[model samples]
Target: AMTVFAEKYGVKYLAAVKCLHKDADALLAFYDFPAEHREHLRTSNPVGSVFATLRHRTARTKGALSQKTARLMVFTLVQAASKTWRRLQGANQL
Candidate 1:
């Protein structure tokens, strides 16, 4: 499929064809999972929330936090946030 795409459109859209070829495995990785779990994997937003938590904390502290403190904060915040996260769908497939 990628070979055909590259051959057909590579002339007009060389950069796009190159990008797709380079990252095709990552782009198609979700398909390797169970169908029922794909949507859950796609929409999972806890990482965003955890980052938001880290962002808010870091922004307030600015340069006040030491590297050790920052790592501890991120670890603790993510651990706390995980308690509230929903279980994955189709977990039995795992």
Candidate 2:
């Protein structure tokens, strides 16, 4: 699949193709999991969302946060978000 993509569109997306090639194993590592859990793996954007949330909240504070305060805020926000996250569907497979 990556080979086909590289052949057909690599020229137009050199950087992307390079990254895909470099991290091919990591990117495809999700397939080693159960099929039922693949959806969760594919849609896992929690870290990005958390970072975005942190950025928005911090931007409002206009750089007034100390390192300790920022760390605490991020930890609290992640803990809150984790409460609403979905559970793995095929835990039995593991």
Candidate 3:
């Protein structure tokens, strides 16, 4: 399948895959984490999600939030949410 793809796509595409192949080990280095952490790390977009929540919260209000207030709001929300966050399966090893 990959050979067919490379043939159809041309040298640029094949070269890109070859480049990635060289970094395959480093690309998968994140799996060194515990199994439980790997699942979360692979699937979750924590930064995007946090910003989405902040965007929704700000959108609900009438006007723009000041820089100080926005910073404080994000800090407060993260602190409150931290209570429900799961610990890594073997975090202490890190």
Candidate 4:
């Protein structure tokens, strides 16, 4: 089916699947996560969305000038992001 689709359309998407096939074991290795946690790990976008704001902050700095500055900056950013984070749908089960 994938071969037929590749022939009909562009091979680009199929090529990506082929690349993933190389790590098929890794890709499929998530089954051990608790069912409730499965949804969260399916994509990094939830945590990543918070970090998107962090990216902007860090992008503005060349690097943390000092360890203390970096630690405080990250702590502050995480606190702010935490307030806006939605509770995961099934988190209570855990």
User: TM-score for all predictions?
Assistant: 0.59, 0.59, 0.57, 0.51
Counting only residues 3 or more apart in sequence or on different chains, how many pairs clash (N, Cα, C under 3 Å) in candidate 4? 0
RMSD of each: 3.9, 4.4, 3.8, 4.7
Ordered from best to worst TM-score, the candidate numbers read: 1, 2, 3, 4
> What is the per-residue lDDT of model 2 for residues 3-94, given as tens digits with 9 covering 90 to 100?
99999999999999999999999988988887898887788788897788788889999989889998999999888878887778877776
lDDT per residue as tens, model 4, 1-94: 5446556654557676676657667867898777777877775576678778878998899675588987888889999888977667677777
Tell me the TM-score of model 1.
Answer: 0.59
Scored by lDDT, model 4 comes in at: 0.74
Show model 4 residue runs off by greater than 4 Å.
Answer: 1-47, 92-94
Best by lDDT: 1
Compose the digit string of candidate 1's lDDT tens values, residues 13-83: 99999999899999999999899888887887777888998899889888598889988998999998888
**Of candidates 3 and 1, the better by lDDT:** 1
* Candidate 4 RMSD computed on C-alpha atoms after optimal superposition onto the true structure: 4.7
The local distance difference test score of model 3 is 0.74
Query: Each candidate: what lDDT?
Result: 0.89, 0.88, 0.74, 0.74
Residue pairs clashing in model 1 are: none
